[model samples]
Target: MSYDNILALNPRIQAHATLRSTVAKKLDKKHWKRNSDKNCFMLSQPNIYCFEFVEKLSHNIFETIH
Candidate 1:
């Protein structure tokens, strides 16, 4: 099989893997902060900026499927 066909076989997994990898890098770089009370993580920036970044990444990764 070709390289292109690998992602075609499972786009969701591929998209999630891409997102996870990006998030991991950001975490290592201390771009995201953990919220223990909320049991989640937030970016070290304004809410709008964080939302836009995530939205753009998601859009780019899943654009082909959509």
Candidate 2:
């Protein structure tokens, strides 16, 4: 019924693993970026698999699809 509930019910969520750490790098701040437009922290990594960055990225991807 709701987005969080939908995410909870997603089977793929259980298929993968969650990272032990919060951010990729605890001390280094270089892995973060400030987008004047999005105003959100962007993970400086190859894949968007990091859980912290998922919600915004999901909306972005679905925006393109719709």
Candidate 3:
């Protein structure tokens, strides 16, 4: 899923923003072009994978209406 999709699904997951930023930074180092892509610049495969790895993490995050 896309970053926005993930964020929309689980706004609470934003608590992990520092971790996400670290992952994005690593990705940026490997793929310079991603830095030019606004969306890609803020997210990365590792970041997405990290979220996916946690079971029910999304559902728990979005359980309440914002």
Candidate 4:
């Protein structure tokens, strides 16, 4: 079977989420850094999630593994 088909069958694989263009535009330009490809700007010194968010993510991952 194809890679996509295999991923579709896999329980762990899920659809990706994307940032809305309007929300993306609100980001500070000072943090923006041009990529070597010059196609997109990556955020430097981006805001990180809180400890609670990290804990939840770890819990979810652990649950998925088991």
| Per-residue C-alpha lDDT of model 1 across residues 5-54, encoded as one tens digit per residue | 99788746444433458768866766455643442356444577668888
lDDT of 2 by residue, 1-66 (tens): 889998988676377776666465543444454534353445554456556468788989999999
For residues 16-37, write the lDDT of model 3, one tens digit per residue.
4444577788787768764354
TM-score of each: 0.29, 0.23, 0.18, 0.30
Candidate 3: clashing pairs of residues: none
Candidate 1 total steric clashes = 0
- Residue pairs with colliding backbones in model 4 are none
Q: List candidate 2 segments past 4 Å from native.
A: 1-52
Going through the candidates in the order shown, the clash numbers are: 0, 0, 0, 0
Local distance difference test, each candidate: 0.67, 0.63, 0.62, 0.64
Ranking by lDDT: 1, 4, 2, 3
- What are the C-alpha RMSDs, in order, of all predicted structures? 19.7, 21.0, 25.1, 21.0
Cα deviation of 47, candidate 1, in Å: 1.2
